[model samples]
Target: MGDRLLEHEELLRELAAVQDWPLPKRMKWAKRRRKEQFRHWKRWIETDEAQSKCARPRKNSNPPDLKFASEIVLLEASARNDVDEVIAFLDEGVDPNLTNIDGLTALHQCCIDNCVDLATVLLEHGANVNARDIEMWTPLHAASRCGHLVLVRLLLEHGADLVAVNSDGQMPYEIAETSAVLLELQEAMEKNGFDDGAIEDARNSGPLQMLSDVKELCDRGEPLSLADAHGVTLLHIAASNGYTQVVECLLTNEAAIDPRDRDGWTPLHGAACWGQYEVIELLAEYGADLDAVTGTDETPTMLASDQNITLLLHDLKTRQLERSARNKSRPRSRTFSSSSRGHSVKRDSVNKKSHFSKRDIAEEGKQFKADADSTTGDVDDVVIGSLDDENGGNASESEQSVFSTDSAEKKALRRSKSPPILIKTSDPIQEETEGENNGSMAQRDNVVQAALAPSTLEGQDSKAELVSKETPPLRRRHRSENTSGKCCTIL
Candidate 1:
């Protein structure tokens, strides 16, 4: 046996060095290693039960009584998920890890059926979480590949190996039926301190034996999406088989919503060709491409075949095209707001400030000034000032702050009460409002000033501003009206 093993190692090494291993030799090596590991595990369990727990401890080759283990009744009860019956059997010393003819433990059956209660009980009763079936599939592999989230978590909590590879040489993560299960497995792997590269090596057996295609579109290009022989992904299979529950589960987990097959057929195309009506609507809701063309230059609608389904696809495509067209054609009016200086105020776009057009401001200022010049003091001032009084007396309060006193108290009060105002004056800020206007002249000046306020802000020029505090979105008002600084602080 030793000489045969040595000879086998040399032959395997030679084949590996030449990169020409045949499938039979590969399977042989894998089987040999597995059997040896199984024997090692059994010996370790028998010798080291006090030291550590065995994951899949083998039974004695010649047992005093084979009655306790290898019973099919426990497995049958587990398959039924009859918690009471399983509990009764476990109390009678029926091993929780008993294997049926297929070498599946009762725990494996519980996982396959997603029997949460039974699984929890089995784990509590010292069932081996990493127990493998004949195919080398642990309970974790069964739960994960079945897309059972709760079962997967239950298995993980019980110390199920996240990176365990089954007979197909795929890890639990590789064959996760749902995106959510895949994420859970990945997170567990990460928590166990497995880096991405380490995990990949475990899955693919290190970097040099890259079975994936090396056809890079460019050195930094995105990986080209690949599929199996027929380019069929799990989603394509579920859709074509009219598996509504599976399709819904995949979509809800955000599987690739519009992956194309080798024939350039999307899952939608498969659903259409197979006359899966609910699937078509579901895919549309999830934003599948309705107009996606196949390699043969046929759309899903063209292949729908059924008249009602064809009309449904047609309507969905029309709506999708309309939405896209509207998006492309609709002007982004809210993007570039009109700036008072007529230059694009791109910076202030985020502030959402309403600005007046330079031309419009100039026109309104001229008209208001003309009106003030024609009528003496207080006429429009009385009308506009009353309208500006907002909240019934805000304008009057501002008036008192501006004209009541020129003392420091008044200055402090104004500063505390209002936002800083922008005033066009070379004089000191205190002096700008120092002297009082006599009668109607004062009222007329106030109205004219509000109307003809500077349309341009000059950095070099000296100015005093009584800007109001910014608040909510400004209500749109005609530039010809409501020129009061206090009235439109938010803008």
Candidate 2:
């Protein structure tokens, strides 16, 4: 079996030397050749004496030398998390600091795998904690980039440098997923009297670039309020995009509610012109100026659409009107003349059957009778004096004062009974005599009447029926139509 194994190894070496052949054909030939060689070796091993001799080692042959014992064992253990095998190899004498082709030590692998226990063991075995990979990534860097908080803490506790830059110029703490971990590391460094200017430098970036950076910072529970190149803050972006959740997050963080961009437009103005009702509503709730006019003298209300936005504008206007009306209605102290305080007459007793009571009827009657009785008394006196002088004075006085009180009362009643005067001209009125002259007024009246008519009683009932027919029926079957599947019945 030993002779057969030697022959196979020799055959493989010969195949390796045949590089002049076509690549594909050579590969095919090599495969077949190896298969034949393996079959011969198997036949030799099946023989009883050959198997026994192959199992035993020759007296003159020594064991193969193990190279870089500690380093290789650590690498294997780091890969597999096998502490016992690693310790044995270290005891067999190997340099702990030996690096692979990439200059990455066992500690780097443990960090990459987030294996804190194995990493601790490597450190205890005198492994270089600060050794960097070809990419200049230390075990600490690997741990941070992978979001391994425990490994990060362990490395920092063991004096890992927080400010070491990798190929991408990111620090260990800067790459950490948890802001708490990064902050704790920074505090520890500060407490230990290490300069923190490096950490501050690592966090610096341009505004637009910071959008992505700020997002990461926010994910790490860090505080950020970065603005872009155009002087637009995160709130502006959120409002422009109509990202309600993002907007809410920014607002919750107390971001400026009315930040203006380079264009001098506030978030409310942007939301208004863009037709974002929800965003506009949110901004309004946050006390944004709905009446704020732009450089063009266009208010947010003017930029809004005619649908529900009108309702919002109407509410704003109504509130303003109410405020103005209240101011106008405020009473002022004033003085009046005696003539303004005319004669006061006592009212008669009220009668239940009368819609306006007896006092009102008496007032009406007094107004209608007026000065008619006064003239009658004068005429009576003239006639009486010519015939006889005895009853002349009394009759003349009675006739002269006949309706003196009633005349003034009648004029007052006429003014009181007049219909209420229309105070506003918002609604148009049609002059019966100008039917041909004012076509617009007639059309307006017709439109108003049509609008005032009840929709259910309008002539469009047949059209409504047609529309109902065009509409699709509800997909969900009613229980009344299929009683067999009904869960309940009213009867």
Candidate 3:
């Protein structure tokens, strides 16, 4: 019998090795061999069954090893939704709390999969509700992350810790996306007398403060370094909201100008990304570093768009230039080493001017100023020139002089004329000296100063000063006119 079995095995192995055997021939031979093997196994089983029935074996099919049985039952029960088979096994001596290699129990699987009914059954059967997986995620954490609001509420009501953090340091509420579910879980926790100290910490950390509080601090001139629960400063909050006034107030108070948040975002980055041009300009004016990189290695200037943030950036560049000129005027005995030359070159390239004729512009400006002075008396007919004169002198014909118009006509010409040829030149040396002079003269004009002042007590003083200096003669002329008209009528 052993020899016949060996011969059959040899034949099967030889047939398997046939590279070019026809499919029909291979199937026929394999079928015959399998039939013969089945016949032999049937005879052996029948003989054994007869003997086993006669003797009655001591153990019924040798119960699986206790540990292996426990592991298999646990794995199968946790993976499948049907709990009947799992419950039967548990009743038959399988441990309900058996953890796999990852320390995940059946309850963890049920919660993660949102099998609320199965989870309830498991809990009733004494499964640990707070059993943690490999990531130390409790069943409540799994339910919250899965957005199972009912399961989350159930778990919380049953005394699941609301503030328990997973390996990722996120609480159940932090992971939950649905506001309704989060609120329900929170309410359930409160009903169960569970306190979320972490949430209270976040609220008290100034994140929940009224806009008035922020404004009051700004009004009272309080700094913006006030840290919240997560160590985020008031600048961080104001920047996130793009609150221009709040940001301006915080900046004026000398807030930590560019302190990075936990995510390494400075106020300038937030302002730039959110298209808050006013806030961005305020931040830049207060000495926020444009070149400073975020945690993602993106600079504020890199994130700024030409459409939304161009004006802000242009203003920043202008201020930077003004600041550089100011600093240059101050005596600095420090010598520039060779290594520092590269950094200086890079800085200068950022605001480089295109090739243009400043001399021609200066000549045009002189001509325009001479024309302006000559036509001041007849300013009503004096036309201003075009920014681009190459367009066939058409715009030059429209250039009108301001001083040539009569007082009544001048009052009608109260509208501002073109920006006064002052912004056309690119030379910082010339721009600083000339622009400063013009700006200072404009500042001295009390009427212009009063018009620019904010409507406050400070503005009222400015308005009074302006009235005394420039408008007194006009006021007197009106009074004289009224007096003369009254006297003539009486006569």
Q: Compare candidates 2 and 3 on TM-score and give the better one.
A: 3
Q: Can you tell me which runs of candidate 3 are displaced by over 4 Å? A: 1-9, 12-29, 40-100, 113-118, 121-128, 173-491
Model 3 TM-score (2 dp): 0.29
lDDT of 1 by residue, 186-224 (tens): 888888988878776665541222212222222335333
Please, what are the lDDT tens digits per residue for candidate 2 over residues 203-292? Answer: 343223435554666778865455676667777655654545566666666777776666667777766665666777677666666677
lDDT of 2 at 237: 59
Q: Judged by lDDT relative to the true structure, which candidate is superior, 2 or 3?
A: 3
lDDT string, candidate 3, 207-248, tens digits? 235356877776776665977655678787677555566677
Give the 10-residue window scoring lowest on summed lDDT in candidate 3. 482-491
Model 3, residue 55: C-alpha shift (Å) = 7.6
Model 1 stretches with alpha carbons more than 4 Å out: 1-70, 204-491
Kindly report which residue stretches of model 2 are placed more than 4 angstroms away from their true locations once superposed: 1-70, 189-491
**Per-model TM-score versus the true fold:** 0.28, 0.28, 0.29
lDDT value for candidate 2?
0.60
Deviation of model 1 at 354, angstroms: 99
- What TM-score does structure 1 among the candidates reach? 0.28
